[model samples]
Target: MIDTERQDWARGWSKLKGFVEREGHARVPYEHKEGAFPLGQWVAEQRRAYGAGQMNGRRAARLEKLGMAWSAADARFQENLAAARVYYQEHWTLCAPRSAGALDKPVGQWLSNLRRPGALDGHPEWEAALEAIDEDWNPSWPAEWQRHYAVVREILAEESILAYVEPGVTVHGMDIGKWLARQRQSEVWAALADGQRERLEAVGVVPHVQALEEPAGAEEPAEPSTAPVSAFDRGVAAPGAVQGPARAL
Candidate 1:
């Protein structure tokens, strides 16, 4: 009786294994069909659609059901998009125009080419040079400026000098020149380290202010408009405006 029960169990297990094998084979053709669903390809398509602002609620839901989380994918797409923008801003000048009246080739293509395997196969030193260029490039000047500005304010505070102008006189503005003059006149300036003075100069808060006074017999220069000049308007190169590694290409 025991032998018969053991044989019955073996037969059942064998049948189950055969069923699973047959089902797997049957699913192969559908899964591997010319235009069937492959996870990587499907995810890529969804990402492209999302990046182009075409992924609607229904499509997003469908993708979620296929094990692709929309949030994670969208975040990655946004990050790549921002990086692409920076790459373009930094390297636009490096790209030669493809034709007359034509814009330079998109930076995306250059990035793709650079990222490909064997991209520097014949010239390994190019890779090292590019890395060095990247190390030297800074793309976060706004933050740097903010920190420097804070330090300048702190130094002024220690001297009890207001760095900003009277509210109605200049519409809540910073008088960089006045602040610099005060610093120069105060003992704090002499006590500051050389690096601190250098930092102040680097931020363009020097004691030198271009005289707006009109020359003798010349009309008073239109009263010198009160409108403020942004850093960009003053010809300051913004973050991502630095030369990039692509210049070597």
Candidate 2:
């Protein structure tokens, strides 16, 4: 009976060794198995034994040498976090669209998932890391709004804010003029949170409306163009239009 147990242990160890060599981590899911062998169940049993001080010293040492991840959630979160830091470094914000990703990780979708209420309830460290990366990573407003705001702010840095950004103007493919027009409308401006309005104002945005005489496009990406004009250029070039700051973002 004892010899049979030894053979069983050896078989499980061999499988785990192969798994670690291939996957680089001993994080097999609980429901995972190999043919008839309950490898994941065996791994969990080993962990439980170690925690309860019932595992043999040699066996525990071997598992430790394999770099077993005691807390799968922590290990996974850390990996995703590394990707997120890289993303933030490049984009300067974590308000990524649902489809956005970085470092081969679906960090944008990951962040969006966390934005759901109670997603990070017990993970204060994750929350803190996100906040450190971008204090407003998760704002009260729609993340899409925050993303567009970021684009407009970037444009403002290059030139003065325009009084009337026309429909044709585009920046990074975003219809800056159309978005601004909606923001400038009476009802829309009033609906904005005070903090949101303050941030927009800081970037030189003010309540605005396109003149009735001009035709425009809808809320969509600015059409592609060579030597494309900017929101600043469009509004500045428009006849007698005067608003926005002289300083750039």
Candidate 3:
């Protein structure tokens, strides 16, 4: 049994859809059609035509009601968009780094873990932070961060350990370089060949270890400089060098 309100809404919606289709405009949600029509003016025109006897009162009322429905839908859509913008602004840091396609699966799993009961007890900020990220939007991180993310993602993907790259598990403080270095030295890193290690070090993923040994049969490293060390060099004294009142004694 079709209620009168449902019947009326269907009739009006059909007309609107037909009009949009006939005009060659792609059918889209009411919110997406904001610029497609001047809905208020169209409703006014229908009312004016009805007053002039160009259309009967029933048809005019139906069209007018349809226009109002579209207006309401559009208003709600706009409110949602504004709210999303605020969410992104507040949580951009968290969302941007995990925006890559490779990170999507782990990110989803991470969010699901966070939403579990009592998971966020002591960390209330995480509730808001996780809510701000929309998996559908896939908001991109800054250009610099994106580059770093890509490098780390590639390394993880190649190693078949993408799970380790999940938020908070690794990448704490967003320090991908440090994380990569630590991972490189882990037991898992033994699976990688020398070439892979060298490649990672080349890109600064792993810190370059200064070779302390002289080349085979080559002279020893130069003697430590006698010039006064800058404040920055205080603790990094030269090997075999003495300092302080011990030298005076």
Candidate 2 local lDDT, 1-249, one digit each (tens)? 479988998998888888889878786644457777878777877776666788788887888899775564655665677678787776667898888887688998999999999999988867986797788889999997887777767667765665545454565466776777677677899999997899888877767544443336656655555876556446655776644432222
TM-score of each: 0.20, 0.55, 0.24
lDDT of model 3 at position 62: 61
What does candidate 1's lDDT look like per residue over 212-239, in tens digits?
6567897645665678854422432344
Better-scoring candidate (lDDT), 1 or 2: 2
| lDDT of all predictions | 0.40, 0.74, 0.42
Clashes of each: 0, 4, 0
TM-score of 3: 0.24
User: What TM-score would you give candidate 1 relative to the actual structure?
Assistant: 0.20
Q: How many backbone clashes does candidate 2 have?
A: 4
Error of 2 at 180 (Å): 2.1
Residue 52 displacement (Å), model 2:
18
The parts of candidate 1 lying over 4 Å away from their true place are: 1-172, 191-193, 201-249
C-alpha lDDT (0 to 100) for residue 202 of candidate 1: 58
- Order candidates by lDDT, high to low: 2, 3, 1
